[model samples]
Target: MSSQVIENHRANAEIYSGAPICIEKSRQLLDEISMPKGLLPLDDLVEVGYNRAAGFVWLRQSKSKQHRFNRIGKTVSYDKEVTAFVENRRMKKLTGVKSKELLIWVTISEIFIDESNPDSITFASSTGISRTFPVSAFELEEDGKK
Candidate 1:
């Protein structure tokens, strides 16, 4: 998101700065929204913020990063700043994220878990294409996390 937008969001928003707290806040937001804790996997996070009333969240990092999820064998890219509107069991209107498929890098627009399919998560691209994967695949087995 642009600096103007971020500045506006900072008003009454719950904001965390620095890697340690930013990582913790990022993971907590995922957990709160029913997403796998490691779904983001951003590096060197500089700030994390959430405006509850607007249901907006943003994460800023030192630089862009490309991560290959070994479990899914797919490369995903995270831009310097990421933003989304989050709700329980869902995240929509996502920006600054993309996933590679074959030779194309598709923009991911939404991610959600169906109430009827509790074990899986679906990622929808801006092109309206989507794919489902096991929720466990994105889970991070980190210390102090069950």
Candidate 2:
């Protein structure tokens, strides 16, 4: 895919409701969307959104233009920047009403539950952050979450 193709896709989506875009529109689309030069810097990922129900991840560059991709349940392919971004956003700070921490926008495999203790779960982020928590402490909510 060429820069022209990406521009065209962006234009086309803008004409519509900006509904989620598929990562595999075609092989050509994938080639075009991939980082042209090198890795996609973490700072370049301006806004990352996930939809758990639809299993879609929306990525926007710093300029606010957005693109969506089908999320793989296992390790993310292509770039670690996205994986890191997703991991960071997945960790939710403990709130007053909620005793357990909520993990938003994560795949089942990305989290592990201790068989010996159903209440205990282990989480590790792409950046190497890991922790264990109670199952009740985490929730998966994915609706326009960044």
Candidate 3:
């Protein structure tokens, strides 16, 4: 992230630090934006910042982590810092996330849920390749609720 942008947002953003609350706040932000809470599933989040006016959000973790979406048998890597411009059902200009395909890892630039379909989410890579998967694949069953 650019220093100027970070400074500006920090001045106007809702900043959440510390592990426990950052985890909750991150999940809450996803819920508010119509995204699956488990979509991020970051570990040991150190900080999170959201600039609602600019739709910019960022997550900082203690270290890089990789998570596997068992439903799709795909793995995604999250850097220590992840940033994006987010809106309802969509995250654009994403940074710090990559998905492994075969032997290559591709940088995912955008993720969106199409209104017409809604049951699926599309991930577009910076390389221009895109893939769509069931939305439920990313949704988590919070607290074991049905």
The Cα local distance difference test for each model comes to 0.90, 0.30, 0.90
Task: Name model 3 segments beyond 4 Å from true.
Answer: 2-4, 143-145
How well is each residue in 1-146 modelled by candidate 1, as lDDT tens digits?
Answer: 35667788889799999999999999999999988888999859999999999998999999999988888898999999888889999999988889998999999999999999999999999888999998887888662264
Higher-ranked by TM-score: 1 or 3: 3
Give the range of the ten consecutive residues with the poorest summed lDDT in model 1.
137-146
Steric clash pairs (candidate 3)? none
Instruction: Tell me the deviation in Å of residue 145 in model 1.
Output: 9.2
* Candidate 2 positional error at 139, Å: 1.4
RMSD of 3: 1.6
lDDT of 3 at 75: 100
Give the distance in Å from residue 58's predicted Cα in candidate 2 to where it truly belongs: 10
Candidate 1 residues lying further than 4 Å off, grouped into runs, are: 143-146
| TM of each candidate vs. truth | 0.93, 0.23, 0.94
Model 1 TM-score on a 0 to 1 scale = 0.93
Clashing pairs in 1: none
lDDT of 3 by residue, 1-146 (tens): 53355677787799999999999999999999998888998969999999999999999899999999998999999998889899999999899999999999999999999999999999998779999998888988663266
- The better candidate by TM-score, 1 or 2, is 1
Candidate 3 has a TM-score of 0.94
